[model samples]
Target: MENYFIESNAYNPWYNLAVEKYLADYVQKEEVILYLWQNQNTVVIGQNQNALRECRVQLLEAEGGYLARRSTGGGAVYQDLGNLCFTFVASEERYDVEEQLKIVMKACQKYGICSHFSGRNDLLTDDNRKFSGSAFSMTSRGKVQHGTLMINVDVNKLQRYLTPTQEKLKAKGIASVSSRVCNLQELNTGLTVDGMRAALRAAFEEQYGRCTELSLDMLNNDKIQEYYKMYSSWDWRYGRSPECETVYSHRFTWGEVEVNLKLHNLIISECKVYSDTLEVQFPNMLEGLLLNQRYDIQNIQIPEFHKADEELAKQLKETIMWFSGVWR
Candidate 1:
């Protein structure tokens, strides 16, 4: 197995995200790439999350922070230069979330911070305060797992910009985002952004042995620039908010989902699904799958979910199927 490591020199969220997408899409079979980067001041949201619902856009922009929509499903997260982000991209056969997490866990232990995975996608301190939030997805070329490692985040700025979903708040039994999260610096005053990066690299090397360091010159410059255009555009960042007559919501062990439907003559005219599920493709595909279908509470035309082979698709498909029998 070949392993490569890249530490992005840029702090721009758009460029960094574009690079991530490209590496995941163009991954070589049995090859693993570990990417590390940061964004100055950004509120990154999940692909299927409602931007307006998850973030205070006007407030964040007015404060000079950017809002970025990532190619993964998860809750909105606030990132600054103090935050370190990592992505593990590999061929489907070589992708292992557990193995990737061990690298991160190993790195944190070096700083005397005993961290562990919480629930499906959160990395928490021994005392249960979350310092990192991760979301994973599948690409045409392979699978990608990327997440934030909060080092010295400004809690005030985070709370100032994000609006957590009530379901999420209720599940964690927390009143606000600030209460549930902590920066690594808060736990260990000696930790710095650069220090954590080095530790992570060391841990990665420990796991994969010698890795080929990737330089910007080796990347596809034109494709990354093209992807940057989408990440930086308003059309891709904030799509029109859905206005539906009915909303069906549920909190499964995997994630929380809110399905909105606008019906016209008993036929579903418009459908929008908002979830924090880790898989990126399924939520974005939900509208097209459910559109133009009958949505009666008694007898609705469910989508052909069996056609999807991904686990998240199967779980959400069952949830949508159950939606047919219930009403909001």
Candidate 2:
């Protein structure tokens, strides 16, 4: 099969993801594609994950980080400039995850970093610290195997942004997220992103015959722009989240506030507010306003109440925002 080596210069997570999907959906020829790219601060969640549960929405908002959902199923991951991402797109007839992983392993081996596949879809160093995690998905014409390579990632930011479940933390036998991850730069200080890209290109050529370089313009056309709009929209990013119910209660200096929300497809299907405060209009004002609206506070429209109930409205907004994990 012919090998096409494509390098993306886009740093936006939505653009990069659109490019990946375009390759997987549009490229139907019998060829092996090796795509290399990177993104800014972004939290990419699996297709089957609950975004609010997988990430700290407040922290991500404050840090100017983006949240995206990929087509593949895997745990949420943090990406930044320090990380390198790769996508292997190939026809189903030539699709083999182990073979794709071998190409990645060969690239890492060139830098004297001995790594091996461990668990289901991870690459770990000799000390068992995970440096890479991959996920797979299939289209009608092709298959995609994509993963992130941690080079010099910020462990503190990763820990603060990603909120893995307690069961997952327990499975790793680690209490903190930082302890389970490692960076290739720590293993070899001389390694750089450019050097890694070069090594990977050489590995691709060695494994499959000579490669032809493809430009981003060839892939970033009108079709990709439509995908970018969908991927970057709030509705597609958050509205497609799985249905869930959450009850939150908090005690303030004034009184106690409790909110129960039943969400379907990330929209507030049912909402009930209970407060011990003497104010009654606050809860009544929010009664029907939140129905059929997104769970996001930014999309919520606040109704005008009596001037006497201004403080109550402010407190009510704060309570809902806090419990819903919404931040400015």
Candidate 3:
């Protein structure tokens, strides 16, 4: 058995993971995987999930520099220095995701952490506080099973960073930032994130095979660049939401902005912004600018208007700037 490890000491969450995904996506089937815990903060969204719906944009942007939308379907998960992430990349012909998860579970059991698989992909403690969540992406070369292991994370920050989920609210009743969360340190008082990562690495190596160090790729490629564009853009993140709906509205200066909109899968299907600002000729200039394109917004082009007059164009630019200022 051959193993490879990508040690990212410091990097943005999305890029670091993307680097791993890109390289792992093409590596040989005999490859096994191990990655050390990194300090960068990140929000990893399920592949089919809308980035915007999974997290609070204002909060995430303020704390975590970038958000990553994965190519697998699951709920959003928060990761930081306090978290230890691991991945198992094996040839699909010889590997099983469930067995890979068991390899991780054995590691947790060593620390007296009674863990069990929850629902489709979560690994929860005996008391039911989730400590690990798993997701998989398959390539012709193989399949990768990746998940996060909580060691001593700031639960408060986790809540503050993630968007509210009705599913979470209904099931756990721990919605929003104010909720119950625990770390291994709180439970055992001896395990650190680094220690946990190292222990897991040893366990995986024993189970999968020998491990080797792999150099990190820093250059931009088409596939990685595309992932960055898709992940960073608001449309791909929020517009693809499955829970939220689109919002539309128009009104005079004093009255309500009577919003009329269509929301599907928590994403804006269509939107129109209107306001009687009277300062610009095209008060509805944002009509074509979607109020909610979410993930698919990256593919849409900003509308073009054929205004020939130089003075009119300048005036329009000023008005547009002013209009944006009001919203800001």
**CA-lDDT, candidates in order:** 0.78, 0.81, 0.60
Residue-wise C-alpha lDDT for candidate 3, range 1-328, written one tens digit per residue: 5677666665566555666666666667566666654535677777676554456644566653466666666677777788887777666665687777887877777777777777757777778787777777888778777788788777776776674433211111112222234577766778887667667776776777777777655435778766656656555554455544433333433332323345564344665554444434343444444455432333334444466544434434443343332211
Clashing residue pairs in candidate 2 are: none
Q: Estimate each model's TM-score.
A: 0.70, 0.89, 0.72
Q: Give the per-residue lDDT of model 1 (tens digit) for 1-328.
A: 8999998998889999999999987999989999999998899987765565566666677678898988887678889998999999999988999999999999999999998888757889988989887889898899999999999988888877785333221111112234388889888899999999999999999988889998888655788889999999766775422223566687877778788777543356877898888867657676776777755333444445455556756765677666654521
Ranking by TM-score, best first?
Answer: 2, 3, 1
Cand. 2 TM to true fold: 0.89
What are the clashing pairs of model 1? none
Q: What lDDT does model 3 reach?
A: 0.60
Off by over 4 Å in 1: 164-179, 240-328
Report the Cα lDDT for candidate 1.
Answer: 0.78
Candidate 2: list runs displaced more than 4 Å: 164-179, 306-328
Q: Count the backbone clashes (under 3 Å) in each candidate.
A: 0, 0, 18
